[model samples]
Target: MLQPKARKAASPSFTSDEKVKRSTFSLRLTKSKKEKHMSHDKTSLPNAGPSYKGQPASVAKEDGARRRARPQTEVPAVFRRSRDDYSRGEVKVSSFSSPVGSSVDHEEEEEDIYRDVDEIEREREWLVCGTGAAVSPGNTLSVAPEVDILDYCQVEWRGSTSSAKRMRKGYEAVSQRFISIRRVRGDNYCAVRATLFQALSQTLQLPDWLQNQDLMLLPEKLMAKCTWITEWQKLPAKAENWTEEMKACLLLLKRKWESISEKKTLAERQAACDALFRGEEEEYSLYEAVKFLMLNTAVQLYEDNQKGLEVPEFSWLLFARDTSSDPFQLMQNHLNPLGHTGGLEQVEMFLLAYALQHSIHVYRLYKHGTDEFLSLYPRLPEAGWPEVILITEDDRHYNIPVRMCEETSL
Candidate 1:
């Protein structure tokens, strides 16, 4: 329950539709005259999904501009199932017969290995307060220790059955390709925390990249890209005030980056990285920076569609999910709030991949199988440099997967 406070909506002054100019990019605010309509339900998937058992409910196929149509109430295929099942922490398993010799004691032992998703709500009282120590603020980030998937299945599925074992077989196949599975906290912020952990960890290890100013300048670049974002950020209608807020955010980002990137030794850098992620203030501040970047990315896409230019296929996901074409609403309802039940969904992840200029590969495992579940945001042809690798079993929470033979601890 130790989560960041919700970010309040900026005042009405920030929502003004006016033209503003800045050095890097031009900013123009024009209200959309297009009547609010739901975006196409079908979003482009990197590849088709695997058939479950014999009932092959493959992912929606691609059509012109849109992917394929689904129910308006249902979320995109990439993230819907887990949210449906895991959000309430209910474990729904297949009715398949139990494996031979499966014992109650064995089930209990396996359950001990993994924490139930439902237990998260009561976590702070035990993990934080019960220890009788001054606990830091923000969600906790555990050390990424390598875990075996077959063992994971025992607890993940609870009572092992033929279906569970078959599912394990599929994961075993994937585990061969992606070796280390590092479990992350199962809170709503799982997606953001997992992705950033991979990104920042990569930045810290690259000696040639430590001095990369582009990473440092990312905030400014995003602001420039979506010049009208200042309005939604709710700065008073003064241009000067907006600029000041931008500067403040930038300064904060720089300070945090330097603390991690400036360390002379690997051990020192790793420690600094740990501190930043584990500390409440640093963790929350970084999330705010990321929220800004995502907001800009969404707005930029919205701008392109407004201009009558053909946006990329991924734009369907954004427009469809946010039918109103209102970036401010997306910010207020989805991105700004902290510790909300749902964190960043696939739509936001796609935007973040573009916003951060990093590819995010999410490996997913469904109830029956794990084939073709690997999703590359933006669906890049080749792995983007500084790629972040993560996996989700239930689709609701994400965990980092260290590639095979990689010495990286995270």
Candidate 2:
């Protein structure tokens, strides 16, 4: 008498008609949702490439035309928002027909919108590569395809020039030129390498070119170093015990890396009297040896505290910073980057600039010297000229730009 036991949950049975109505209701709702999704997604919807809901980008226009012929009451619920958006993002659908009172009704349009929103929220993702671009999960945003051309380019350039801006311009011109000449695109580096050899046969395939040319004379007279296959494609030295030559190459190559700040010219640089590389009599270490080579030969740097001994390579050369473009790796990868000696940086840039703009002419290299080198590179307006001039014992470090008027180029 106190309490009735909990009764079993009642199972309500329905007649065939009620069952059929419920099934119909669910089927319409699902179809309405799918149509709503296909309509809103402009990418997947074919003719909607321009803009129309519920139509593939291909047939969207035709479907839209047919939609216009129907009455407002006849217009499906899946298309209302897109049709309404006619005044906005989509193309105007003028003189459209009446909305149709379908099984789903106009409410299906809202359902589709909500369906798309739900999918986007569920699938979205992104990543941070420093402060650069992000990758979204949806195919809605286009992927910026990268341009690669390594085939026609077996060589890499590495250097800092007198002017960074001119150097950057030079690289862009070079990249554009090479891309055209090699016909490199997609997965065509292999073809590029083959074509590069064919087009630049003198540089890549001429067996006799470097045999008679001096490394120094080529830059002076040929506007090029004998472009030959590097003896060891893979270097022989290891990092722990890199050869003096290897160390020379790496430090020389270091100027190719990207950095945050612009560099100062010799005039703006703090005065230094140090010998960065040469160690004292008893304390000579391998690290010091590497440092000495890097400072005096590669980067052309002297110590900040003590130095009167002249390092011939570093003697009158300016230490330049290489900061050319976004994804700074492009130039080093594609162009012949650095010239070996410090004094040749501007000359290399000048030659690279010419090559970037036109097919290389050997005669351009010989006509002038330092005077020609100064005229082409990138620089701040105020950084005067170089003190360098023709072959003489009195070579100095003054900013006398290579010019006909100044005799610096002579």
Candidate 3:
């Protein structure tokens, strides 16, 4: 939980008249009936300024009528899932929807019971960092649209606090190399979102890459080499269901890619990709689909190490079993859930880069200065230029970094 900011003491230089006016204004804003009424009818407030102290009566009446006529925004279908449905691990697999749909329909119950919880969870998650408040309760994860890095950090840079200085300095460092940042929501899926957004978007932009069936089948290849169906079934009762779920998720990815690949023009493909990411169910399914590949990679690494076969030095250590930790258990606890477990670590990021056969270059920023600001996963010279460019302020959360020339690419 975040602590409330300490209030500053009033300056001794303030005159009694000024102090009295300030106190009176604050009291009026909170205690007055007119203010309370205005708060409920916010649309009536004039847009010319922040205050409604001197708005014309005629304009307010017109705005009020318009507000009354406006319909309430409908919640998306993906967010309407009940707690029970989510706990059962049932998901919508309709053509463009998520992986599987529940036979039981609860449309009435969905509108009545879970809507408020979902809204509260969404707002709470946005306010808190690194806290999986939304996903834990089975609410749909939200993604914020991309914004300029300068604009994203602008609010923090206005204060005289230490945090302000840190944010300002970090922005200055990033501004030198990047023009904008697409904030991948930090709800433990940041790594998956950032990687897919960059990698998939690049494929859409490049005709040669989109046309390559081998590239499209990369997930299947990873599964074959890493996850054996016979061995996977040995894992508890969940494995049987997971096998089916994994197949559905894999199909979801293929269909989405096929849909995007059908576009003849670069702009059309880009537009299709944008629409795909915007859908919560489709995006969540794709995120889960990638995790299967990640889990398979982890399993393969663990088995190879057990057999004394060569593996990446650091990558193998992450999944190396201890007295308390098993690689399979780690995957169940961390990879199965949407949020609250944890985001991908260094090993997984490297695995993703290798699994996708693309280099990932990340620009890192810190509170204080550092000798280096860039890190590349699977830093092989033979991999050539990075297909994904990312930025991180604290390293825990990752976002897409766009250069001035690459704005159109996003």
Candidate 4:
């Protein structure tokens, strides 16, 4: 009867409260079950990441032991080498798989040394022989040797039967006054040397700065004087008016003249001159410098002698109609060395003669025929002057050897 009364009247509010509590309890139980299931699933999954809160004690202890076992101060020896030691190969580098190191072979580095030495020797041999080595398209080396131009020519002395017989017809027609005929070295500089030698021999007779040296030293001394003159002419005010070609000529003259002056022996000086002629030691051709120097020296002498007298037109007369012609070019053809063309013109010769204040008598002896001797008198005997006799051969080649006579009395 009491239960029937309670059931009928669990008051509406109390009944609702009981129902709410029951629902809350049921929800809490379901949530707790779900949370436990999720935790079990995470533990069973193999690919699940590490969990900090759920980590095992054994695994944490193992990591701490590994950290303690490592040596913090110990490093490999290979990493301790200095930069210079590495560069010089003092320290050996090893392959990652190899424990022991090996060094580079020095013998392999020196293999080409002997080959380089042999090549240098071969080059020296070629240079001494006056030959150049040419490399062909086939990778073959060939040498071309230069021939001495004088080797093919015949030389004759004055008054010899061979000379007299060859000149029999023209013997009386030419002046027979020279004392001797001497052969000179045939090369690019022969004409210049011969002319210079003759000029020096005559000029040395007069009292000048170059009067004290022996005849053997005359050439070098004359070169020094000429070099000094060239230097003096190169002063700022004077050189400003010179063309580039003229300046180049002057530079070549100075270089060659300096080289000759520096040599202590005649052989050395001769070698230097030879080098200059062959274009071995100089960049500029020597012939132009020689021609320019000769003309300049002659002009200087003429001006010195004429002092106050009205000087005649020398350079202008040499290149008439070509008023703009370079004086250096007018003196000689300097472009080609092997070619026997280009020399002082007649006007230049006359100027040289006038500068010398002497008569230049050239007697050319023949190598071929009966009318072998031809005489050239630059200025006639009526002009009272010092005499310079130049003896030459029939060959019109400018490089032929020539000699100045000991006695030039005609």
What is the per-residue lDDT of model 3 for residues 179-210, given as tens digits with 9 covering 90 to 100? 66665555456677777776665554333433
1-410: candidate 4 lDDT, tens digit per residue: 23321111111110011101111100000000111111111111111111111101221111110001111222111111232332232432211111111222343122112124444344334331111111123322111112222222211123345444454323222222221233333322333444544433333134222233342233344444333223222212323433444555545544445546666654455444444433232322333444444555543433343354433344333322121022222222221111121223234444555543545444443422322232222423324455554444332212222221122222
What does the lDDT come to for candidate 1?
A: 0.45
Q: Give the Å error, residue 89, model 3.
A: 21
Best by lDDT: 1
lDDT of 2 by residue, 199-240 (tens): 221121222211333322321221112122121112234344
Superposed model 2: Cα runs more than 4 Å off = 1-180, 183-200, 204-240, 244-410
Which 10 consecutive positions of candidate 1 have the poorest summed lDDT?
48-57
Model 3 / residue 92 / CA error / Å:
34
Cα displacement (angstroms), candidate 1, residue 287, comes to: 0.6
Instruction: Report the number of clashing residue pairs per model.
Output: 3, 45, 5, 1
Looking at model 1, residue 106 earns an lDDT score of 31
Q: Pick the winner on TM-score between candidates 2 and 4.
A: 4
Best by TM-score: 1
RMSD of 3: 20.1
The runs of at least 3 residues in candidate 4 whose Cα sits more than 4 Å from the true structure, single-residue gaps closed, are: 1-180, 201-290, 295-316, 321-341, 354-359, 365-386, 393-395, 398-410
Determine the backbone clash count of candidate 1. 3
Q: Ranking under TM-score, best-scoring first? A: 1, 3, 4, 2
